[model samples]
Target: MSLSYVGTQLTIYVGSAILIAGVLGNGINIFIFSSVRTYRNTPSTFYFLVGSIHNLLYLAINLTFRIVSVGSGFDLTRTSLAWCRARSFFLSTISVISFTCSCLATIDQFLATSQSAHLRRYSKIELAYRIVLVTMVVWYLQGIPWILYQNISPISTTCVRTNAIYAIYVSVYLLLVLCVIPVVVMIGFGFLTYRNIRLTIALAELRADRQLAKMTLIQVVLVIISIIPYGINNAYGLITTGMTKDANRILIESFISTIVSLITYLYYMGSFYMFLISSSRFRHAYHTLCDNTTSNSSSLLCLVDDDYFCLCDINQIAQCFLYDKTLDQCKHCLAQGQCIKGDTDTPSDYVCRCPRCHFGSICQHNTKLFSFTMESLLSPDLLSSSFIKKSVSLSMYIIVPALLLIFGTISNIFSFVTFRRPKTRLNGAGHYFFTSTIFSQLSLFCLLSKIIHIIINLRGLFVQPMVNTILCKILSFLLSSSTRICYWLIVFVNIERLYVTIYPTKRWLKEPKTAKKIIIFVIMLTYGVHIHELIQYTIVPDPKYTVHGKWCVTQFSHSLQIYNQINTMIHYLSPCLVNLICTITLLIRPARIRANLDKKKSR
Candidate 1:
């Protein structure tokens, strides 16, 4: 086979493997959760079952589509429009629902476990019914755009515009529903979860197995990673689809879409492992299964003591950081022990001692009565940071910024209302600039903040093997670009004010309507300047967590670092520069003119 053919085969196999893994993994969870008669009746079971259902559907579609697309031999561009639209609509909907269901599972775990007595008694059947209703509403809600604008036929695998007007309508609707609404919901929930976690931690409430909340956080990250590639792909598609008939971009986007689909499954599959690591029950069960299946396995060499689980072969902890073989000492306490000791045991095999109050086993003490206290956990500093972090919690991220935008818009409305008032009809140029600033701030605020958090938060929740060097750079660029929009708007405000004062009779400054048009134009232009950032910062797996059995994103390139510096320069330094220059000009201009007039009068 040609290298191309081999690559294609590998892709298909990988996709299949991921799909099977997710289905079987989640299916086993379903069986285990269901077969236990006591477990089947619990309210939490409903969420777990529903989340599994969504995962199964998502995996099936993803696996089938990827395998078919790879082997089908037909130009993706030449596939039937119906096939394209239907596939697009269903897959997107399922993907969204999967993430949403997972999030709901987290929420359910919180409410169910936290409030055990009266609230715990809520019927599983009623919970299932409510989920069904929600599923129905969400399905129809997401399907509207598909029904209205989806054009699938065999000739070309692409979206068919009902017409330009309808296309715009569908785009607007889809943007609001898929992109905007979920982002808002995620941000809200993220904030709430952050607060709850902090409070739990602070109040000494977080036990060893607070897996649900962490699982929820991981789910959020999955959504972010899944959406980002798709979001960028779609956003780019929307911008360039009509302007350039480039096959490469389309193909590139399709590849990204496929990758994102696969990663979404990875997110679902990986969470079970996270649960296994964090939850004692899952960990115990998993280890029991592993031991039962492979009596003579290499893993059998591992030893578990009261303080630590050790991998004999590697001389390291089962899950945590590796021992520094070269140092042969506790790098964690390097200040005291810089050199390796003569002891045969590796540092990784050494049990991790608590920062304070070194006593018996660290894990055992956690469960001991009066060993921990809410007062100790909920320290003054911890509480303060919790308040701040919660105030800016990821869930409320969208609403807070959105509310700020609304307030800015309201400020404009006030200006307009004042202008229309009989008493204030003769409002001056300052009023016009103030009104203009309101609209500018509103537009930039809504677009930049919402889009940023939507993309950023989703990445945090979902992206696996988290370090995608390329993706990190792309994200950094997009962030820089988004922030630039705000800075540029501030510059415009200062410039407009200075212009009106310096040349009041200019036709541009005379009409408030003209100023509004300019503001809108600037807002639109902001996208053009930063579009390159999205392209430059492509998604790649994070490096730090990959080796240690954790996943996350981090920037790899200095290009993003440069861009960040530039953005900071513009956002902070430029605004300050503009303000400083304006302030000095306002102060000095009058004094200079008066001095000249006095000189003329004496002459």
Candidate 2:
């Protein structure tokens, strides 16, 4: 299997494991730290409490999407426009908050361990509360740029940054704020806290304070280990973005990126486990709490002896899964889906991990990206390999193309001839009409070539490989550019008429000189924008993913797709919209003058 696919399968389980473990661990941490009166008001513990909540939020929202995205191979952010803008905003805001809380907990521990009374006083619960509140507000405000910049990219059909300047700022922010600052602050304070306890173990460090210090300090080390690799990966990505690589190298890089991204979640999930390892008092608390639980009777507690291995077997794990059949966990499931019980002990803890199309937690959405192509739309049940032969009778395909070519040629020639007269060329309107007629002829000829190319390939006809390649590039390039040229020429025609409508007395408005310049500019601009077709377009033989016999195809890069689609829209819509507005305004505010007539009365 390719590493990307393998990595995707791994993430399906890994993300689930993290979600379950994180929720349970952080859940217990929150309960023990809050419910136990001895630890309730301590500033370090307060930060721990808040950090646990942030970790839960991170796992629930971010890691859940990460798992669904991998399992289905479709990102929700890309498909849903609101989510495209909101996911980045929330993830950034919440992650920075979680990282900030970790730092605060470490720094608070340092102060709690310090010999100085002044620095120690700074570790107050009231100040901790205010700091977290202010941090939330600041980071929420900081994430506003993401709301403004994140968008569903048209080319790649994925969510990505839309603004160049904002994208650069995001890269810098990812490197420094999310990756660097928290690690630095925690490590620095973590060591200081450790040194204070080591130097003055007998002087004044209480047992609880020492345990909390050890927990936070050990957690800091884990943070550095988990987070620094993530930072380095981000830097490597930035450095190598423009470098070209073979397909295998691209897959390898993608595999590594996926692996590193999963590892980054470890920092958020490992804290409670870190506490369990570093604090004996914390472990004692866990046992004491678990032994006392009466809510769910089905439990398994495994204890391994130093002298021998012991296995604890408990029946009735699914007892809680069926605790509430009326809960309707399978409401979002597709056909033949099975729900798996999770979330430790809750009755509402079922996630629908289906055998097919595991799209969401409950399998609610479609598993694949949906799109339409000409062959598919025309004959949904027919074989795509021999498209034209299978979809069309021999006579029908021949007759349609013949009719189109004859009528199109005649109409364009007639329009060209009509606009060629000197009397008709007295104004810019005639020039625009003549240019459009020429473009229309160009479009018709390209269309005929495209039809011939498709028919030859699909009907099992042979052409030389190099000839096919050249035809593929030339035909697609000429067709797209010529069609867009026509659209833009119409746009300019509307604009010129609108100008004449507004300024009837301006003699320059009636000249054909500016019209000629604009037509040339439109043709050049359209050709320039579509020049990528010459390089990006190519013939693919017997490909299942795209349409046509020559099979002209190129996958859109994320930013390029969004940009190209928007540009096409502007070219297509600008003229139609300009025409509507101009015609309506011409109707609304009739001009005072007319060409070659008396200056009209003021409306």
Predicted structure with the largest lDDT when compared to the true one: 2
lDDT of 2 by residue, 1-603 (tens): 779779888887777676666766777678778886657667778888888888888887788777756654446686688988888888898889889989999988888767665776687788988998999899999999999988888998898999999999999899999998998899898888888878763311222256778889888887888899899998998998789999998899888877887888888888877886687453222222232243445355433211222222243111111134333334333333465556546655666655332233333222221111222223222343676765565446556767887898999888888999888888887888888888788877877776666667654465587888788788878877787788777766776776776577885756788778877888888888878767865555432322433344433453454445445545555555446644644543342223213434433
- lDDT per residue as tens, model 1, 1-603: 544555577666666566555655576566656665644554445556666676777666555555645644322323456565666667657756765665565555455434233543342457755875688587758666765566644454445665678777556655555555555566566666566545543211222224445555556665566555545555665776568657765566556665655554576565444444444232221222233334445544443323343333322113322344444444432102233344546433433343222122111112111122111222222223466764455445455657767776677677666656645423234444454445555454545443443345334553443344443444444444545555655565566666655566775753556655665665567566555545543332222212222111222243443343333433545455455545545554455557669989999
| Candidate 2, lDDT over the whole model | 0.68
lDDT agreement with native, every candidate: 0.49, 0.68
Q: Provide TM-scores for the models.
A: 0.39, 0.47
For candidate 1, the per-residue lDDT at 89 reads: 69
Candidate 1, residue 274: lDDT:
46
Superposed model 2: Cα runs more than 4 Å off: 204-208, 282-603
TM-score of 1: 0.39
Q: Which predicted model would earn the best TM-score?
A: 2
